[model samples]
Target: MKIGKSKNLRVGEWVVAIGSPFQLRFSVTSGIVSAKGRSIPNGSDSTYVPFIQTDVAINPGNSGGPLFNLEGEVIGINSQIYTRSGGYMGVSFAIPIDYAMDVADQLKENGYVARGWLGVSIQEVTSELAEALGMEVPKGALISQIIADSPAENSGLKEEDVILFFDGEEIFYSADLPLTVGAIRPDSKVNAMVLRDGLKKTITVTVGELPKDPALAFNETQQNFLGLVVEDQINDGRRLYIEGVMVTSIDPEGLAYESGIRRGDIVYSLGRAKISNVNEFKEILSSLDQEKSTTIGISRNGNKRILSLNLSK
Candidate 1:
């Protein structure tokens, strides 16, 4: 039996796991409740997901196996193990039945899981960022970029804005933002409180349907780091419009990547010069003589950021 999803799980439940350890087949292990709602890093990109902690003596090949209650009702799936000698260390972890069910459902329905999107890119507020910018303690998610015409952008979210709460939920860490916001239903208007320039501002945004495909938005290869493909920002009418080169895609290895520059960042100005279009962007790049690192200021998510990047000759 494969148990997925933790919504129905309870503490103090007896559970069993069956799998192979070190190629041992049909191994069985049992344990009582250890803990629940523990978080683990999802992948290399630094996202986190909550998991169930169990002491079921699990090991390799045990992953994806079911954890059963004494009643034989599956409660979790053995997923990971903590080991010092390439073997079970008596401590193992499982994806809760509910969470697993959610993952499986999403994968089956959408070909991928659609996480709730706040439509903003954020960074952990640092003390220097706090002091340099007069923040409280570097504990909130600072908006580094906001998607244009996105739910966040439409709701007036600005760059450099520090998010303190979402739907009355305190956002102390970056990881919490996604989980809390994703739990909210799409197409619902919700309140978000943020500290903009040290002042708290509340805005309401209707959560948009999250895209089923992650690659569609991230497919560009030469766009700026601020999340926009520009053409020009300088028509008498366009100056009011704020245009620039049409972004093609992000340079995956460019300075934009390390600086948290997303796929749609728009190039408005390099340093202080206004780049009207792609030709202007070329001019700016051509003007550079392979000297040292240059400070690039980009416009993203209705805000601006300065990044120092070393240019390769």
Candidate 2:
């Protein structure tokens, strides 16, 4: 059977899905492509798979089915469904057949699949973030943190640089970046266009193999202090009036970053003073002695850690 590429798929194109739903063998269903390059959050797996979204009836056991084009070619493989009721709810996703075949080939040849990586944590360019960054429009992925000694750092990809294009592919959202970078082979040179300080510049990088442990990119609100950017803990559509500030971004060379402070750390206190919000944190930071060592309390992955900032040194 001919394998088709998802990049060639057009929205609203008629397609057929073949699956065995609920013990029904070779069940057939029809639907139109709803979207392409859809990022369905499924932990880290979604970062690599640029899914094809459709309204096809994909139920339990429908996964691993072939999604065929009208021309009788397989374009994708049914992978998942988005449902709040534990069943198909009109939104189904498929892994592009071309991508699947590539992985299959790698597994057959090397016993494992290797993906290219640029170790930079990023966030979506929301309207507020755009204004803050002096961008005319909300687009592209904004670098929030650069993992130490990673390819991104080696390439001089600085924090706060907005990556508009990578390897000639435009990154409209943060999610688009992972899929684009992962497709390239390791040690391959790629040019990335970035917006920095209201200017656009291109930087060349040699892509590296994704580490055994992947670095994730995430986002939050604003409060710039102690060389750290933070926001209040939010839950269920509201800021949880908790005694902590969630770290979003930090200057790579700043004391906070060097002192074991990292993005996603929940700073609840400095020394003995409790931090209730961004404003309070700022106030506490203003009163700190730049020449004195200070201990800070933070929570990471549900574990509390006390990181010392030896500012005096």
Top-TM-score candidate index: 2
lDDT of 2: 0.80
Residue pairs clashing in model 2 are none
**Residue 72 displacement (Å), model 2:** 2.0
The sequence of per-residue lDDT tens digits that candidate 2 reaches over residues 116-218 is 8887777677677788889988889888778788889999899999999999988887768878888777899999999999999999988988765421322
Mark the 10 consecutive residues where model 1 has the least summed lDDT: 40-49
Quantify all predictions' global Cα lDDT against the true fold. Answer: 0.63, 0.80
lDDT digits (tens) for residues 43-65 of candidate 1: 22213245677777777788988
- TM-score per candidate, in order? 0.52, 0.68
